[model samples]
Target: MPPRSDSDNVGFLVADVTRLLRAEMDRRITAAGLELNPGDARTLSHAARCGSVRQNLLAERIGVEAMTVSSSLDRLEVLGLIERQADSVDRRAKLVHVTQAGEAMLESMQPLAAGLGAEAAKGIAPADWQRFLDTLKHVRANLTAARDQLRKENAAA
Candidate 1:
């Protein structure tokens, strides 16, 4: 088989798409006059999605350093968008929860997100979009399982 070009590589394509999408979303958020910056908006969204989660785990989920997430969380707390409470099982650890105001913020952002999604789906049919999402989910699951297997092997070595 011939070597694949960057345009033909799945990883490259995925990364490019993700980066472009994030950039566009950030631009839209700024244009929409949202008070929160992109990082803080993302932090709030992730915290809301994860419900009550530990700070370290939230950092991991957001793919950012704990300190970076901490800063975002601080800003969010000041905005009354999230609350950090002591963990019941671990007194030293804090669990992050999206406050009512955070939910409201998320709701406000829904129209922005929907508009972006609609724009992205401009050429694709509904069925094709569904299939694409399903395929991506399957690819993600395969990669996650492989990662887990590697971790287990490394632990046992």
Candidate 2:
């Protein structure tokens, strides 16, 4: 297939939306005293979701280095938001788990995320909203595939 023209391509739109969301999230998190960077927030959220995730797997899922994940986990542990425990299955490896504080923080961030979504959807029609969501999912899938392809190419190179 032919490549899309710059204007026709959805990349710019996706990038802009991502940028805006990050900024809004940063603002809200700062206000809420989470004091976390985007990467930290994402890591914490992942830990919260997985209950207990392998360190390497969490890093792979986040598309970051294991070292970065380790550092973030250290900071989170210090903050009493997360803990690392020996993996039950593989006694040699450690798994990440969110503490009660982390759960509370995640819960607190929900309303802020909802408010941001509501604000973005303001004045949009119902049909348009559905289409918007569909387009977003499509974009997400496309980007995920691209990321996986890039990782493969990088490994080969």
Candidate 3:
């Protein structure tokens, strides 16, 4: 069996792609005159997608620190783009929801995002793109399951 180089490793390739994509997205967002920075934009997007998620959970979903999400939420609330309401089940916890303004902002950014996606897929055929996405999803599922198993084992130790 031959050892794989960094460029040929799945993890390295995925990380490189993710880093490049995020950098490019940030650049485009800035060039488009969007008021939000990449981190805030990402937080809002995830919050909107999750629909009334807890602050901590939203942070976990977005792979950011709780304080980072908290700061973004503060700015978003000030802009009237999102609101937080007391959770019925846990008074100490708040659930974040995107306001109408937030939805409007997301809609405005849709074309920018779609254009970037098209650019990234320029050399790939539609079928190949779909297959690539499917494979990525499968890989994500496998990794998630393994992570869950590790957490359980750690908790039991």
Candidate 4:
């Protein structure tokens, strides 16, 4: 393959790092005998943090499709890690919440979650690391807004 242009490097580097971090997490999670795959870990963890949340909103928070989240929720529900119930206010919607068992699962994954990005910048000064994480959050917010706008436009058609 031809050499990648410098212009493409930033996105590529970010993507590579994401892939590597996930691979490491997967390895650790498996070794720990956790039943959840990475996606399930995320779904359960988010539910634990957010309390009861609508399935659609959970999908948005995790940057995944509603159907994908639904599938994971189905499996998690079977595993007794989550409970999905009809939304109290919106009968048409489902709200998912973690069960007591799920709380234990989230506790198990905490170490892996806490370590995810810290390893990549092991030597970086703490301030720079904080700034970099803050910048990434800003970028994520901007991208999420643009994505929501696009979704709104498409849904109006």
lDDT of 3 by residue, 1-157 (tens): 8966768588788889899888988888888888898888888899999998999999999998999999999999998999999999999999999999999989987888898899999999999999999999999999999999999999999
Clashes of each: 0, 0, 0, 0
The CA lDDT of each predicted structure is 0.93, 0.85, 0.92, 0.87
lDDT of 2 by residue, 94-141 (tens): 989899998887887889888988888899997999899998799789
Give candidates' CA RMSD values in order: 2.3, 4.6, 2.5, 3.2
Better of 1 and 2 by TM-score: 1
Q: In candidate 2, residue 26 scores what lDDT?
A: 75
What TM-score goes with each of the models? 0.92, 0.74, 0.91, 0.76
Task: Report lDDT (Cα) of residue 120, candidate 1.
Answer: 85
Superposing every Cα of model 1 onto the true structure, what RMSD results? 2.3
* Residue 90 of model 1, lDDT score: 100
Name the lDDT value of residue 125 in candidate 3: 99
Residue pairs with colliding backbones in model 1 are: none
Residue pair clashes in candidate 3: none
Which segments of candidate 4 are over 4 A away from where they belong?
A: 1-9, 63-65, 148-157
Q: Which stretches of model 3 miss by more than 4 angstroms? A: 1-5
Residue-level error in angstroms, candidate 2, position 37: 4.6
Residue-level lDDT of model 1, residues 21-96, one tens digit each, is 8888888888889889999999998998899999999999989999999999999999999999999999999999
Q: Return the top candidate by lDDT.
A: 1
